[model samples]
Target: MNISSLKLDSSNTVLVTGGAGFIGSNLCESLLSNGNTVICLDNFATGKRENIAGFASNNNFTLIEGDIRDLNTCKKACSNVDYVLHQAALGSVPRSINDPITSNDVNVSGFLNMLVGARDANVKRFVYAASSSTYGDSTNMPKVEEIIGKPLSPYAITKYVNELYADIFSNTYGLETIGLRYFNVFGRKQDPNGAYAAVIPKFVMQLMSHESPTINGDGSFSRDFTYIDNVIQMNIRAIASNNKDAINTVYNVAYGERTDLKQLVELLKKYLSEFDSKIKNVETIYGPQRTGDVPHSLASISKAKKLLGYNPEYNIESGLKEAISWYWKNLK
Candidate 1:
C-alpha cells in the first residue's frame, strides 16, 4: 500500500516516541519524507542513536532525548505535536519475564503518561503500538479483535493494558485514539543483536555468519509475521482516517497468514543464500519451548482492511527477500 498518497496533513508536527528504535525510526523517516515535522523522543535505552542519525540533519526532524517513564518528558514531547505515535516500550516476553517491574514501569506506566500528555495537549489523534500477544492462550485459528484470552506474560499484560487505557482515555477525556495490535513485525533496521532480539532478525544475523539458528520448539510454532512497511502503512492510515468508527478501537496489523518456524528458517536461508550460498548449509538446532511462548498465533486482518482500508504490500517471502538484501549489505 502506498501510504504517502494518503490525505495526512504534512504541515502537522508528529511525535514518535522511541524514534531511534527499529519501527519508530522507520515511521520517522516516512513521516519526514512526507513533509511533516517530526519530533523523536527517545532515551537510548534500547533505541540506538545511529538509527536516527541519517535523518537528524533534516530540518523537519527534531530529537528530544528523554524517557517516557517521566511524565514531564512525555508532556514535553507532546507539546505542540499534532499527532502522537507512541512506540517506546521494552519488548520481548523473556525480557519481561526476567524484569517484570521494569517492563511494567515503561510499557504500562509510560503509556499512561503519553496518553495523559496527548490528552492534555489536545492532539488530533493518539496512535500507539498494541501487540498480538494480547491473544494469549486463545486457540482461535484466526484471532479477531473482540475475542481475547488471558495474557501469557508480563509483556502481554502491558500491551493489553495499553488498549484498556486507550479506550478509557477516549471515553472519559475525549482523546481520539487508535491502537494497532501488531503481529510479529520484522524488516530492515530491526535489531539483530540483543539478548531479546526478535526471531527473524536474530536468525538472519546468525545465518549470515553461518551460525546455527536455534528454534525454541520443534519448529512447529507459527506466527503471523508482518512486514514493517505494512505496519507503517497502518499507522499512517490510523492518523489519516476520518472514519468516526475507526478512531477509538484497535485493529490487528498483520498479513493474515501464519508462518511456522521451520518454514520461516527455510525462507530466510533461501533468500540469504542468494547473497552467500554457504548460508544454505547452515544447520539449525532445536531447544525446549520457552515459557510464555504461544504455540501458534494468526491474525484476522479483516478489521483493518474493512475499516482502515489496509492493504499489506509484502508477505513473508517478499519481505524476507528485501530484508535479506539489507542485512547482507549492512551487516556483512
Candidate 2:
C-alpha cells in the first residue's frame, strides 16, 4: 500500500518501545519523517545506539532510556501518547531455550507492564510485535492466524501469552489492541554480530568477510522473510485503521512467499557478488538442526491484506538487493 494513502495525522504522539532496535528504529524514522511526535523507550540491552544515531537529533523524536520491565517506566512512556507500538521483547528461540526465566521476565512480564500502562494511560490503540514463532509446531504451510500449534519453546509461549493478554485486556477493559505476527523480518540496520542474529544479515557479514556461513539442517529450511519497510508499513496501517473489526485481532504480516536456506544463500551470494566477485565462491558449512527451530515457515497474509489493506512493496529478491547495497556501503 502507498504510505500516503494511510492519512496519518502528524500531530499525534506515538510511543515505540525498543526504538533503538532494527524494526523499532525504522518505525521511528518513518513516523518522525511524517511529522509525528515519536517517543522511543529502550533499555539498550540488545538495541544499539548506532541504529538511531542519525535521527537522534530530530526535534520530533524523544528517547527514554529505560527497561520495560518496570511498570512505572512503561506508564511514564505511555503518558499522553495517542498510540503505543510495543515492540520491546526478548527475541530468539534458542536464547529462550537456554534461559527461559530471563526470556519470560522480559517478554511476558514486560509485555504485561506495557499493556497495563497503555490501558491506564488511555492510549488510542495498542499494537505490538507478535511473532510467527507463535505458530510453533504447526506443520501447516502458509500459516493462518486462527490455526496455531502448541508452542515449542519458552519464547513461543511468551509471544502466545502476549496475544492472550491483549485479548483479555480488550474484552475486560475495553482497550483496543492489534497484534502483527511478523514472519522472519530483515533488512538494513539488522545486527550481524550477535549470537542470535537473523540468517540474512549473519550470512551477509560472513560472506563479506570470506568466511563460510554454517547452515542448520542441510539448508533445506525455508522462511517468509518479510522486508523491514513492509513491517514499518504494517505498523503504520495498524495505528491508522479505524475499523473495529481490525482492532483486537491478530494479522500475519508477510510477503506471502517462502525461500529455503539454500535458495537464500544463493540469492545473497548473487546480490553480494556485485560488490565483491569473490563472495560468490564462499563455501557454506552445514550443522545439525537447532533446537526449537521449525523446518519451514510461510504466512498467509490475506488477513492483513483484507483487514489492514497491507500491500507489501518488497519481495525477498528485491529486499535482499537493497540490504546488500546498504551493508556494502556501511560495513565494507
Candidate 3:
C-alpha cells in the first residue's frame, strides 16, 4: 500500500471527486498516506460509502457528500484545492447506452462544472479519468493517443467528449489538465456485486459463490486489463510531472498487454482454487456478446513512459494475486 510521488508529498491538497468509487478511493487512500490533505467529494450515487469507511477516523481526510452535476458543489469542492482529480462520472458502456441522457448530464455537464471550478480556484493541475473506450472502432491494435476512431457507444462518446473539453479548457482557460485513458482497470475496493460490475471482480464473486460466470462472446474477446495500483501510479505521475508537453494531453494507462476472457477465466480459477478447491471445478457459461462491446482492446503506454515517467509495476498475474487475496480475506 506504500506510494511515492514528487511535488505531491505533503504541501499539496487534492480534491478527488468521486472519491468514494474504486479508483478515486484508492487515490484518496494513497494521498492521505503520503501526508497530503485529501478532500473526497462523492454523492454515493454509484460510489458506496463503505469504500471510504476506514478513512472516517483519519484527520487529514475530509469527505464532502455532494454530486458533480451541480456547479455550486463542484466549485465548493474545488475551493482552495491545489490539485483536482476529476473522476466523477457514470461509467460503463452498457449503462450509458441504457440511459444516455443521465450519462451525458453527469459525464459532460458535470465535467464542465469541474473544469470551470478548477479554473476559478486556480488549481495547479487537473488529472481526470479518461477511458480506452475513446478508441471506439478504430480497428487499430495498440491504440495511440492521437489516433482514435468514432465512438462505439454512448459512454465512449461521453469520455471522448471529456478529452475534448479538457483540451479546450487548457487552451481557452489556461487550466492545466491530464487525461488518463484507463483500460479495464481492476483491483481491490472494486465493487463486485453491482448490476454493472466489472468482469474480474464480478467473476471472482460469482465463482466464490459456486455460481457459473457467463462470459460473453466465446471468451475470445480481449482487454488490456490494468491493475488499480498502476492506475494510481499514473494519476500521481500526471499530477506531479513538470514537463510542459505532458500537460493538456491524454495518455494510455495500461500494462501494455492483452488478456482474453478465456485466459482471464483460467487465471481466476487458478488463483481462487487456492482458497476453495471447489472453485476449480466451477463451469463458465458462454453468452451472447452484449452491445457496445469491442471485439478486442489494448493500449500503448509509450507516451505515458516518455511524458509522465509512468512505470506500471503490476501485471495481471501479480495484481490478481494481490486482489484475490484481499477479496478472500474481506469478501469471502
Candidate 4:
C-alpha cells in the first residue's frame, strides 16, 4: 500500500518542532493540507522562515519563534496540542564532531524537555526524528530496529538517547511515543547554505552555481536517501496509527534502496543538466572522508510496513526530480 492510502484524523492540533526546517516544514504543510491545525516552533538556528512562509496566512497554521532547548517554550507549544512531532535537533555528523557539547545539549537535553512537556500536556502521541546514524558501526546491510550498533558520533548518540528516553517515558509514565529512524531524507526547503548542509541540497546548490561539488571519500559510500513526502507520510501514520503493535515502537523510515555517492552525483547531474546544460560537464572533487561518517546505510522498513502501514511514496529518482524542480524554482 502507498502512503497516500493511509487515513488521518483531521481534527487534531499538531505541534511540529523545527517546523521551519526541511522535513518539519514539509510535514507542517502536509498536515495543513489534510485539514489539521499545525503549530510550528522553530529557533531559526538552522531552520529558515522561508520554509513556512506559504503557510503563514493559513488559519490552520501558526508559527512560533522559539528554540526547543527551552523548557518554557516547549511547554507553551505543547499546550492544547493533540500530537507532537519533535523534529528540532542539531543534525549532521560533521557538525556534531565539531561540537559535541552543543549537540548533546540540543538533541539530548532538549529532547527530554519536549518529551516531558508533551507528556504533561497529555498529547495523544509523540513522534520524533531518529537517524540512520544510530546504526553506527554495525556492518548490517539493511539496518533493523532491534539490532543497533554502538554510536560512532555525538549526533548518533543523541538520537539513540532519544529512543531510550522515549521507551522509559512509555514504560514509567505511560506516555505514548514513536521514533522514526530516518535515512538520508532530501527534498525542497532543504537549506544548501550552511557548511554542514546535507549532500543532496549542497550538491544541488553547487551545481546550480556552476561550481564543482565536493565528494567526501571515494564517493562510494551509499545511503538510503528517502524522500520528504515519504517522511511526512510516516509521521502522519505514526501519529494516527491505532495498532497496538505500532505505538511506543521505533521504525526505520527509508526507501529500502541504497545509492552510492557517485551514483547519486551522476543522477543529480543528469537531472540538473536538463535545466542548464552547463552542469552536464561539471566534475566532482574528492576529499578525505570526514570523521564520524558511516560508510554505508540501508533500512529495512518491514516493521513500519507491517505495523504502521508506512508505504513510502517516492524513490530516489522520483523524489530528486521533484526536489530539483522545487530548488530550481525557489533557489535560483
Candidate 5:
C-alpha cells in the first residue's frame, strides 16, 4: 500500500479548505499520494467536485461540502486534523470590484473562522493561500515579502488582510501559521469556463476550441506564472521546515521570473497547435485593459530559498507545456 510512508502518522489528519478547487484539489492529491489522511472542505462556490474526482476512491481522503465562513463548519472540519491548508477564497480583482462585500465575507471573514478553528483544534501548522495581488501598486521588479504597496483592488486588500490577520493570530494565540504568497499559480484542474477564469487555462481552452483568446492591454502585462506542483511543494516545505525563522512568516512562492501576456499567448499557441495544427493561426483579441491588473509581477524567492529550501522545479514554459497538454487530453 502507498499509504504507510512519508513519515505521516495514519491517525494524524490534514484538512484542506476549498479542497475541491484547482489548487486545493492538487494539494489534496499530493498529500494523499504521499500516504496522508486528508479531509477536504468546500462549498463548491467556485470549486468543482470533478476537480477532486480522482481522490474519491482513496480510503485516506474525506470530502465535506461546507463553507469556511461558517464557524461550525470550520470547527467540524478541524476536529482531529493535525495540519490545516486554508485555500478557500473568492479570487479575481474584477470580481471583487463588482462584489466586494461577498469577497470580503469569504476571503476575510472566512479566513478568520479557519484561523480560530485551527487554533482551537491545536493544529500543528496552519498554511494558507496568500496571493501576489498583495504586492499591489508596488513598482518593484522582483517583489520581496518585506516590501508591499497599497492595495489597488478589493481582492488585493482581502489577501493582504489574510497575512495581517495571520500575523495577529500567531502573535496573540501562539498558533504556528505560514502564508505562501503565490504569484500567478496555474496548472491542471484550473477551471476554464468561468468569466473570471485565470489566463493560462482560459487560453488553453479557447485555443483548444479554435476560438481566439484575449490579451488585455497590448499583451505586455507580465506575471510570474508558477506551476501548481511548486506551490504544493512550498506548502509541504512550509509545514516541514525546521528553521525557527520560517515559522509564522510569509514567503513568496514563485519562479522568480516574468513572462509577458503576449509571450504567454505565443507559447500557448505554439504548444496547443502541436496538438492540432488548426490552432496555429488563431489570432488573439486584445481588449480594453483589465481594471485591477498590475502591469508586471515578478517575485524574489530568496527568503523561501534560504529558509524553506524551496527550489521551484518548473519555469513558465515547461509548466505551460504540461498544462496545455493536460487540457488537450481532458478538456478537448
Candidate 6:
C-alpha cells in the first residue's frame, strides 16, 4: 500500500482500460497519486463514470470514452502510453452462460484488440487482470500459476484465452506482458447491485439492509478472497519490477488462503454488526449450488513472491473489516 515503496516513475504515462470499474478505477487512483499521467479508456458497459468522476479536475487524469472491442480505440488509447493496465472485460460466469456471444466478443475479442494495440504502440509493459476462473474445474488446494485445469464456463474460456493471447503476443511480437490471475478480489468501490455482483459486497449490502442474503449452496464453497489493495500492489510491482524472469509470465494474485461461504457470511455479519448491532439478528438462506462454481479455491502466490516480490498486507479478516466499513458509510 506504500506508493513510495513501489518506485514507480512519476513521468510515466499509463493507460488503464476499464478505468471506471472497481479494480480499474482503483488502479487509476493509485497511479495518479504517484504523480503519473493516466489515460482511462472505458465503454462504461459495467464501469461507472462516477467512479472516476473525482478525477475531473486533476490535470494528470484523462478519460477516453471507448471500448476495447474496437481496435482503433485500443490503438488510440495505447498511443504514447508507457504501460497498459488492461482491465476491460465482461466478467461473470452466469452472465456468460446466459449470453455467451457478448461475453466472448468483449472478453476475448476485446482482449485481442488491446494486445494488438499495445504491440503496435510498443508499450513498455502490458499488465492485465486475469481471472481465477481460469482454474476452472481444478481441485487444487493452493492453485499455482503453472498448474491449471480446463476452463469450466464461457467466461473461464475467455480469460484462459487471454493468457494464451498474452503469451503469444509476448513471443510473437516481443511485447512484455504480465497476467495477474486475481482470486475473488473485494473492497471499496466494488459494485454490489448487479445480478452477477460478487458475494462479499453483495452480502454486505444485504446484511446492512437487514435482508437475508442467500447462499448459493450449503455454504461450503470456498475462495481465496483477495483485497483490492493487494491486487493494486501486484500490478504496480509488475510495472516496477526489473526482473527479466517475471516478465511475459502469469502470477496468482491472492492472499494464499481460502474461506468458505459459511465462514464468509459469519465474518460479514460479525463486521457489519460493528456498525449496526441489529445486523446480528439478520439471517441467511441456502439454495442450490450455482453451476460452473468450484467447490473450493485457494492460491499459491509463491511465483509472485519470488518474481514480483508480492507481499499481501491484508488477510480475509482484516480485509473484511476495511471493506465493511466502506460499505457501511456508503451504502444507500
* Model 2, span 90-163: residue lDDT tens: 99999999999999999999999999999999999999999999999998888999999999999999999999
lDDT of 1 by residue, 1-332 (tens): 54569888889899999999999999999999899999999999999998999996899999999999999999999999999999999999999999999999999999999999999999999999999999999988799999999899999999999999999999999999999999999999999997999999999999988999999989999999999999999999999998998899999999999999999999999998888899899999999999999899899999999999999999998899888888888888
User: Model 6, range 1-332, lDDT digits (tens) per residue?
Assistant: 76758889899999999999999999999999999999999999999988999999999999999988899999999999999999999998999999999999999999999999999999999999999999988877789888889888999999999999999999999999999999999999999998999899899989988999999999988999999999999999999999999999999999999999999999999988888899888989999989888778999999999998899999999999999988888875
Which residue pairs clash in candidate 6? none
Colliding pairs, model 1:
none
What tens-digit string does per-residue lDDT give for candidate 4 at 1-332?
Answer: 23334677788899999999999998988888888899999999998888898998999999889888899999999999999999999999989989999999999999999999999999889999999999999998789999989899999999999999999999999999999999999998898887888999999999999999999899999999999888988998898888977999899999999999999999999999989999979999999998889999999999999998777879999999999999999888
Error of 4 at 204 (Å): 1.1
Off by over 4 Å in 3: 5-7
Tell me the whole-model lDDT of each prediction, alpha carbons only: 0.94, 0.94, 0.93, 0.91, 0.90, 0.93
Expressed as tens digits, the lDDT of each residue in 112-159 for candidate 5 is: 999999999898889999999998899987899999999999999999
TM-score of 6: 0.99
Candidate 3 residue-wise lDDT, 1-332, digit = tens = 35554555687899999999999999999998898999999999989899899999999999999989999999999999999998899999999999999999999999999999999999999999999999999988898989999899999999999999999999998999999999999999999987899999999999999999999989999999999999998898888888998999999999999999999999999999999999999999999999999888989999999988888999999999999999999999
What residue runs in model 2 are displaced by over 4 Å at the alpha carbon? none
- The ten-residue window of minimal lDDT in model 5 covers 1-10
Q: Candidate 6 regions off by >4 Å?
A: none
User: What does the lDDT read for residue 225 in candidate 6?
Assistant: 96
Once fitted onto the true fold, the runs of candidate 5 whose alpha carbons sit more than 4 angstroms away are 1-11
Between 1 and 5, whose lDDT is larger?
1
User: Who is ahead in lDDT, 2 or 5?
Assistant: 2
lDDT of 6 at 145: 85
Clashes of 5: 0
* Structural similarity to truth (TM-score) of each candidate: 0.99, 0.99, 0.98, 0.97, 0.97, 0.99
TM-score of 4: 0.97
